[model samples]
Target chain A: MKNIFTGRDIVSDKGYITKRNIIEKSLQLFSVKGYYNTSISDILAATNLTKGGLYGHFASKADIWQAVYDEAVCIWRERVFSGVRDRTDPMIRITKFIENDLRNYLGADVFEGGCFFLNMLVELSGQSDPMSKQILRGFVRISKLIQAWLDQAADQGLLKPGLNHKEIANFIVISLNGAAALYTSTRDDTIVDQTIEQLGFYVRQLKA
Target chain B: MKNIFTGRDIVSDKGYITKRNIIEKSLQLFSVKGYYNTSISDILAATNLTKGGLYGHFASKADIWQAVYDEAVCIWRERVFSGVRDRTDPMIRITKFIENDLRNYLGADVFEGGCFFLNMLVELSGQSDPMSKQILRGFVRISKLIQAWLDQAADQGLLKPGLNHKEIANFIVISLNGAAALYTSTRDDTIVDQTIEQLGFYVRQLKA
Candidate 1:
């Protein structure tokens, strides 16, 4: 059978749309109520799909959780990370990554429901599930992005001699995630702005 | 009815112990699995309590969650905040609060599972439950403690002129929480130490 998602089959277009619909709706609920609190019935109710319709699209709640997490990471990479990738200057690149991607895209606006990756980290970190592994992989990816930039900047002699790039990257990631959590609770935009500002100050202090 | 918790009967002492047992065990699970994922059955399994015994103590999972939250906050305040309260110097108090209460008590060792307050904040914020309200109150209380110290430090002319105490307090709270979340997943002791060290640097930069 041709898949409607790929326009390969007109017959299965409805099936593809139905599956996409379920995933979209599930992502909204999972990001807000969380994966555990968000019940299958909640997905059905929100999607206005009967039990059969919901089950037809995703076999189980866990299946939909995987979809949601994958989609979230994809969005962060394509929507957020892509923009920050083109800058040639490491300092400018890193700062923009923090300001645009970390502070703006991953901040309260795109994730007003809450950061899916961070939510997963808090909710599923220690569990030996595929979900936990994927979340950890995302952390490593982001940390490497920051560390690479810091290392490049150090090579360019913009930063002080003997700077610990990995430690600095960890500091930035820890602070950004922390800021995101605080902003999620308080809905205080200042926290986000202040985090970026403080991070900038830390970087400037490292200048040669 | 005479309360077993009040030692009205020998049988009641068992009841009190049973109730305490449920809360303590639930705290561990909730810290990791979170409130929603942690089913009553999980509690029964961990505590080896019968369905009726568990139900007798907590009407529902929500009830046990409320009790756990209250107990977590109480412990943080009494055991964590109390030590920081006794310091006469605002600088010493704030520093000790970061090192002793925050770094030692609420850091990785005590919160290897997850930070109870932060876990609740991430899981429950914007949910409109009494639990969410209580968690927000805890954030406010901690923020106030930090702000009070910053304000005093500024008044004592120990800080750089024209400092925004509220913003600084917000920074520290955000960073501490961010550090906690990172440590939860990585189990990296350096994250905890670096968080304290970075916080100290922030404070020293504020000093006159």
Candidate 2:
């Protein structure tokens, strides 16, 4: 039998679509209710699929989580970085990335609950499982991206000579996550506006 | 009967002790595993209590959650505010609060998983239940404390004129929450140190 959940085979075109549909529904459920709170039965209920049907698509909920996470990363990258990918100026790229993240992705509430990664990051903080690693890996990837840009800025003599790039990257990540979490709970867009403005000021101040 | 979960009547002294014991254990479980992920069975296992014994203390899991949250709040206030509560200088109170929060609370890993309020705030972000409300209220209480201090500083001509007190309070909160969440996930002490230093700088900068 063909399988889309695993990369063993191409799977049938219809099977691929069905798998995608399951992933999409599960993403919403997991984003809002989180991984542990959301169960296979919830997936089946939300997808309107029978147990046998859902199991046929993904071997387990963990595999489905991996697939959902991959989809979220793609959406995050496309929405937050697509505009700045071609920009060579590091400050432009960094500022635009923060702007896109704050205004477009987080402020826009791309996911029903909020940023998929932030919600899952807090949800999976202490777990040592593969599921938890995936969330941490996403955070590392973003941190690395920002660190790379900061290093690039330093190489170009745009950023100050003595700043710790990694710490700065972590700071940006922490502040944005905190802002997004608070905004989600409060449903106050002003938090988003203030965060965007403040973070923007911090980013610009990083210049040489 | 004397009831601790609900203030109805007095039960046995053993009952009150048992109730307190359950709340303490459940606070650990819920801090790490979160509300929906932790089950009544998990509580029974952690506390080594029978199903009937557990039921006698809490009307439901939700009630247990309330008791645990109240206990966490008391602990939080006592640790994070006890020193600053006696100080009259707003900046001293503010910096002392942040220092206690970072150095003593988060940096020391006072809770096994991390800050209880940060964990629960993210866990319950989108929910509208009373449990979620309690977490949000904890956040609001903190924010209000900071904002009130900021306003007091302004009145004393210690804070820079025309600063948005509410926005500044939110910034400190957003940054600290972000810092704690990241620190919890990474188990990095430098994050806490850097956060304290930077937040201290930011606080000092707020003065006239």
Predicted structure with the largest DockQ when compared to the true one: 1
lDDT tens per residue, model 2, A1-208: 6565764555576677889999999998888888888989999898888999998988898889889999999988888986898998988999899888888888887888887887887888886456667777778789899999999999999986788888888788888888977877777789898888777756766787
CAPRI class of candidate 2: medium
- Quote the true-contact fraction of every model: 0.64, 0.57
Over the stretch A3-118, how does candidate 1's per-residue lDDT look in tens digits? 54675776568778788888888888887888878888899888899999888777889888888777777777665555677888888877887787556566636654667777
Q: Ten residues in a row with the worst lDDT in model 1 chain A?
A: A103-112
Kindly provide the TM-score obtained by chain B of candidate 1 when compared with the true chain B: 0.89
lDDT of 2 by residue, B49-120 (tens): 999999988999888888988898888877888689789999899999988888788888877778888888
Residue B79 CA error for candidate 1 (Å)? 4.9
Mark the regions of model 1 whose C-alpha exceeds 4 Å error after superposition: A1-8, A48-59, B1-12, B50-60, B78-83, B86-89, B101-103
lDDT of 1 at A118: 73
**Model 2 ranges off by over 4 Å:** A1-11, B1-11
Candidate 1, residue B199: the lDDT equals: 73
Reference-based lDDT, residue A40, model 2: 92
Task: Give Cα distance to truth, residue A6, candidate 1, Å.
Answer: 9.1
Tell me the chain A TM-score of model 1. 0.89
